[model samples]
Target chain A: MDRRNNRRDAEGSSVITANRLLDGRIVWLAADGQWSPHIRNARVYSNVEIEDALKEQTASAQDNELVGVYGVQVSLSPTGPVPVTSRECIRAGGPSVHPDFTPEWQERPAVSPA
Target chain B: MSHAPHSSLPVGHYAYDEVDRTFLKQRVAQFRDQVERRISGALTEEEFKPLRLMNGLYLQLHAYMLRVAIPYGVLNSGQMRTLAQIAQRYDRDYGHFTTRQNIQFNWIKLEDTPDILALLADADMHALQTSGNCIRNVTADQFAGAAADEVIDPRIHAEILRQWSTLHPEFTFLPRKFKIAISGSPQDRVAARFHDIGLMARKDENGRAVFEVYVGGGLGRTPIVGVKLRDDLPEEDLIAYLEAILRVYNEFGRRDNIYKARIKILVQALGVQEFRNRVNAEFVAMDRARYRLDEKIVAAIQARFGVPDFDPAGQAAEKLIQQRKADRAFDFWVRTNTHAHKQPGYVSVTISCKPAGGIPGDVTSAQMNLLADLADQLSFGELRITHLQNVVLGHVRQDKLYALWQTLDQNGLGTANVGFISDIVACPGLDYCALANARSIPIAQKLSERFASPELQREIGPLRLNISGCINACGHHHAGHIGILGVDKRGEEAFQITLGGAADQDTVSIGQIIGAAMSEDETVDAIARIIDTYLARRTAGEQFIDTCRRLGTAPFKDAAYAPA
Candidate 1:
């Protein structure tokens, strides 16, 4: 799987799209719309093997998918909008934003039964 | 004449908002259903335990104790009035506000629980997470945003954590109970360091909010200070980091042995670093898609808890000084009873519940109602539950000090010994609590009676006498200057005394038990004997604690154990 996209790159380019799970091994998300996990120099794309193995998530997909990271991250901006942290924010401590999983992503059974 | 205490101050920080009303109605219906199911035996004791706990019902010595969550320790007159109604109707004419910023009614019957929950729900309150092995009522510095000396409003962070941890899926069944405390002020009046997880808000070089996280600290069989997990956690990673630690504890903490199940024992066994590594590892694996702490939500919450419109109409500090100069008692009260507030015209006034020869932290139903009324009148309807187990009215104006003092004095609450020796913290031992080995209230009463005179208490200076009936230490005996522990010697109740312990910013030391255990009468005589010895030997202005440290416990030990 293309794990490099998960790593912070100094160049900060949009490369390697879609989340790919390989042989029930590891999970990795892409940096862009590409379904693969491969990148050449600064240019990144879905790896040929990964693209061949997996299908597209959805037609209208964004840059990154949080397939691997555990908790959500909200960045702090000096002049931008600040986040809410109290119980009032959550009607009763539920998720702030519900991510819509693609049908394919939702249909996929667990690699191992949980 | 109101049975409840009265105040001349104006009420503050209150609103009967729409959201609160909706939630209250919903919770009441839910609880009413649960109570009916319980009565019908559809819900067994085991099945109903978690549900009842969430509603703050505990099966204690005589009956159930309904602990109503007082979020961040802020309450107005209306809420207090509701509490009084509950106490009068369901309980035995009283309620106890605990160190955790919650109020407990000890004599609640299971049958009346649904109605009690309904009452609390009407007041925009719930008893959720007040007890049981779950994320408890999130506690913060009671003064919070209002205290002038605060670095940041810790309540904001406290509120955030409360939302994050409430009904958290994986952590519902932990090895043992967990406690989290946060403070925005450098001078931690909340005693954050001694908690299971302590968060202190600090500023980095960039002047952004960062948290100093302390982990694996708690008080019980073993008392220990929390080790620093992160000196400066970036504001963004607060929830993620906390999730990581909790996940690790839930999965790996010991469950077979109840006593050794706390995260503290696991931390001690695995060592802090190893525990940290496991937490980080679990944190890294948590599916990020499901975890979302959004910017918009944070802003919305902050907006709701915005600073009150505070007006500095009068110079309270100057007036206080003038009053202190005119009246020596008022001067003493100002010095000992008042705490500095962040706002210019406001001060936090502590109404001592440690009445002479009475139980510490025990407020009658009438007194509670009065305090609630006083809160609505004198202060901005804002009250505080201190870790010392005393009640406080923050945001008191200087111009109203004399009038407030007069009212408090008329009530049994005006002890005027805030930081002094007589202001003690004693657990309800054999008289009320099931876990107690001996009676603690008697010892506390004896000491209170001996030092009941205000002049004598002042002469003794600031000292803490914490007494616990058993080693469970609900009374916090280890932190007292003269810690008295009641041990069962064979079948007889015996007292083991310790000296030179202090829970202050600069010092934290468990007291050393001196000599053999004494019988109940001898224990009081022994304490009286020790105090007499301190009085005879102490240098000028030397408090009981300083003298104990100087002379060591040797002299006291010799005298305490010797024949009377």
Candidate 2:
């Protein structure tokens, strides 16, 4: 697979991602097959499990819940699953223009997705 | 003749006849079916993507963006009010006016597009050919009809081009998107020399209309000023000449590399003389009778754009002159925002959307409504969206200037700086656009705040600062006196500054990049230093571009990189 556009680190861990169909909100596939808004709640797949995880998420994505489903690289950090590339980081956090508009900015005091 | 209210009023321009209404209805029905098919899994996303894009539905970072074409930047108050309604009901509470004479709703939904299009069709507007490789909305000078220097109302020809290019079968899927601009005056207000095709209207010695046709000018990753293809083509031969040009481009334009697909690249690769020779050959061989414009049709279009009955006795009221003399701010706005109108006692008012530190080109639903009301009262119910991201009331009576200015001031639309530094042209960068590499709005806001002082802006004097988030140059940064391009360097946002680029005038030149890119924090100071350098070097009464030309980029480059 051509993974050039993905945000993989030295360790090849990745997460299946898409935008929620209705509002175009960024979403990641969790282990329970439901989509989560927070990237930290994403089911991180190792290099070996990546293909299967993507396949399963693709099926879920086609169920009309998500759009533009694809895989993005992530690293299993001590804190949580962290995006590798700046593009993915922007998608995970929100637009860099306004701090108040970020997804995490409002959900800061809430329960940790990880 | 008594002025009618909004409901009873007739818009002076081309209204959709039965045939036009049927065409739009058919298009909407077709799009609705396509949307259903995509939703029901009958079509794959890959298959539906292009189909959706053809109708101007773009999936941006956070939501769907719907771009509605305001053909030739002309709209009546009813149409403007309808746009406000669409923004309030269908998408976000505000819409961004684009440099291409289009308005974009950033928070649109895929399902809601068909209904929104239906609403636009009611206003005799549509989102057709607003995206994908097609003849997009034809742009013209905002002051097309009202400008005193104009030879003819270019909107008449613009409307003609719109009718001919709307879903033209052969040219629908060109190698890349095409844009055409028309200017009626010696002053190139529409940035005519920077489009895929540019048409300038002029009259022959016998007082018959002729056009100076320019081809292959574009601003993208590769910016090029168009070369004149035909100096004097008869106005009736507009369609035939355009067909010949498009045919030549469609046949010979590169389809292999996406980056090299624009007609400008082809023109550059094959030289202007060779390209013009090929186009002339095509023009000679074409069936002239089939594409020739009829005189009756041209007359009808021209009649639609006929000047309204002016209040002959209209003059600057005593109160208005008193207000202007009393209030310095009012005097400044009058001097800057008002343009010379063709009719006596009439002036075109530029309602600036770029209030200090505000987002460029963004108008809220309330502001839109207010503008609609102002248009109805002051400008004979017509308004124009300028390429500079400001709104224009093209037919205001000079007597009512003070009243209109007061209303605009109260509504946060009256900024005294029209062609000044605070009046910035910026694109929706990383904030909303998916294609953007870095943020633009924040930088524009920062710069506007830094140059917020009217005294400072007046000192700066007629400097245009344009910011584009990427190399696409949607904001026309390459045209600004001080151009700022945002790029991603080492996974961080950085800005590259360009000096001495210009558009719209005879000395049209693409800006040259000065020094390396600077970080976001360093950009404001760097720009300030560059301006300081210009102030130090400029001769008395010299503009920013003149100063840059006199003293080369070396001094400005040094100032840009100099330690604070």
Error of 1 at B353 (Å): 0.8
Q: How far is A60's C-alpha from truth in model 2 (Å)?
A: 4.4
- lDDT tens per residue, model 2, B181-243: 999898988777889999999999987779999889888899889889989999879999999
The ten-residue window of minimal lDDT in model 2 chain A covers A105-114
Model 2 chain B: weakest 10-residue lDDT segment is B1-10
Chain B, per-candidate TM-score: 0.91, 0.97
Query: Native-contact recovery for every candidate?
Result: 0.00, 0.34
Q: Model 2 segments beyond 4 Å from truth? A: A1-5, A46-52, A74-86, A96-114, B1-12, B317-319
Once fitted onto the true fold, the runs of candidate 1 whose alpha carbons sit more than 4 angstroms away are: A1-114, B1-24, B286-297, B313-315, B535-543
| Model 1 lDDT tens row, B325-406 | 9998877787788887777777789888887777777787688888887876766566777666788887777777877888
lDDT of 1 at B176: 81
Measured by TM-score, the strongest candidate is: 2
